[model samples]
Target: MLLQVRELKVGYASGADVLRGVDLSVGASSVTGLIGANGAGKSTLLKTICGFLRRRGGAIAFDAADIGKLQPSQLAAHGIAYLMEGHSVFPGLTVEENLILGTWAFRKERARAKQAVERAFELSSVLRAKRKVKAGLLSGGQQRILEMERLTLNDPRLVILDEPSLGLSPKLVHEVFERIAQMKADGAGVLVVDQSARHVCAASDHLYVLRLGEICIEGPAASFSDRIDELVRNFI
Candidate 1:
């Protein structure tokens, strides 16, 4: 498994539990979709996996090593990249500068860093066009794509995306999904959380439905879509 979570739990100090014994796994070269309604703890699970949120119990293992105790930066160094929801890029920097910062972990290796930026620009044509423009001036969809490009720069073994389609138009959403498909084809394990069931299910190899802070169902993506309406009515 590229990533694994066993009985994971997380919650705020005074709030009710947000994740209750959540368990999941992502296989190499596979795209997994996580679906849930708003406030269903989908984002919480991603945060825990990326080490941004504390794990109150259970374990998260990446590449067969225990990562539950690793810090967020440590997890990033281990090739675990997370494209967080909303605007994650630096508002003050140009697109190229923002991308260069993405390679901060490899700052000592100037040649590799330059190569990664070149690859990112190649993969995302929008970034190429807006390379000299400040990231804050880009459209929401464009910014999201840039975030994904930044996350993929290091060729992370596992990528976690939170609500990647949230603010995109239909056309842009299709482009994003295509990019995600390409990632899986390149042998990167991907775990994506999104509310668009049709698009997400269509692109994923496997599916996990989360409701009330727990996984309600999981199966092959095709089968999951066939039963999505019924599942949502019962679980969501």
Candidate 2:
């Protein structure tokens, strides 16, 4: 496994526990889908794993090392890239500028950075055409593409996403999953939490259904595909 969470638990101050004894894993080069209803603690689990929130109990292991104590920055340094909900782009920076920032760690390696930028542009021709335009001016789908390109630039070992296709059109939603599928194809482990069970199952190899902070069901994505609607009404 590339990323693993065992018997995880989390809660906010003076509030009911948001996650309860959750366990999930994402294998190298595979996509794992986590689906749940609103307030089901899907995002909370991601936050806990990335160290944005403290775990009340259990463990988090990434690439076989215990990383439960690592902060978000340290987690990123360890090859875990998290794309939170909403458009995570700088309104002021141009598309190319944002892409360059993604390669900042390799800034000294001009050749490598330039290659990464080129490859990113190749991933989205729209982005390439609008490379000099402000990211905020791009359409929502295009901005999502830019973020996708930025994350893949570092070749992170694991990519975690929350609500990746929330407000996009069906076509754009498909595009988001296609890019995520591409990330898996490129050898990155992916753990995604999304609103649509059908779409998630389509892109996932393994699936975990969260209900009220606990994993209620889990299996191969194909196992859940047929009952997607039922699952959404019941599990989600």
Candidate 3:
């Protein structure tokens, strides 16, 4: 496994537990999907793994190295890229400028930076057309694509996405999953959290159904799709 999370526990500032004994893993060659209801600690788990939240107990290991206490920047150095919910681009910057920021890890390498930018453009013609426009001017889906393009800059080893297809049109949502396939082809592990269990199951190799921060069911994605709808209702 490229990322291993064991018996994870987390609490809010008020000491109320949000996650309880969660176990999850992601591998280089697979797409791991985590599906659950609203406020089920799905975001919390991803946040903790990315070092945004401190774990109250258990371990988080990446590539066999214990990294439970690393800061977000340090975790990024280990080839982990986190795309949290919402549009996180610099609203004032032009789309091209934002993409250049993504290549900061290799910006000094002129040729490499150019290649990264071009690859980002390849993901969307709209991005290329709006390259000179302020990022804030783009629609919701376009902004989301911009963020996705930025993540591909340094070719992260593991990509963690939270609500990746949120507020997207059917076409744009399909593009989001297509990007996931591209990531797998490029050999990066993807840990994805989606509200739609069926959509996630279709794109994942391994599926984990989280309910109130606990994994209620876990197995190969295919095996769980048939019961996903019922499981979701039960969770509600």
Steric overlap count per candidate = 0, 0, 0
Worst 10 residues of 2 by lDDT: 71-80
lDDT of each: 0.88, 0.89, 0.90
Q: Give a tens-digit lDDT track for model 1, residues 171-203.
A: 989988998998898889999998888888899
The digit string of per-residue lDDT tens for model 3 on 94-124 reads 9999999888876788999898898788868
Best by lDDT: 3
For model 2, the superposed segments whose C-alpha errors exceed 4 Å read none
List model 2 lDDT by residue over 60-121, tens digit each. 99878999998887755687888987779997999999999888766788999899999888
Which pairs of residues have clashing backbones in candidate 2? none
Model 3 residue runs over 4 Å out of place are none
Spell out the clash pairs found in candidate 1. none
Model 1 residue runs over 4 Å out of place are: none
Q: Model 3 clash pairs?
A: none
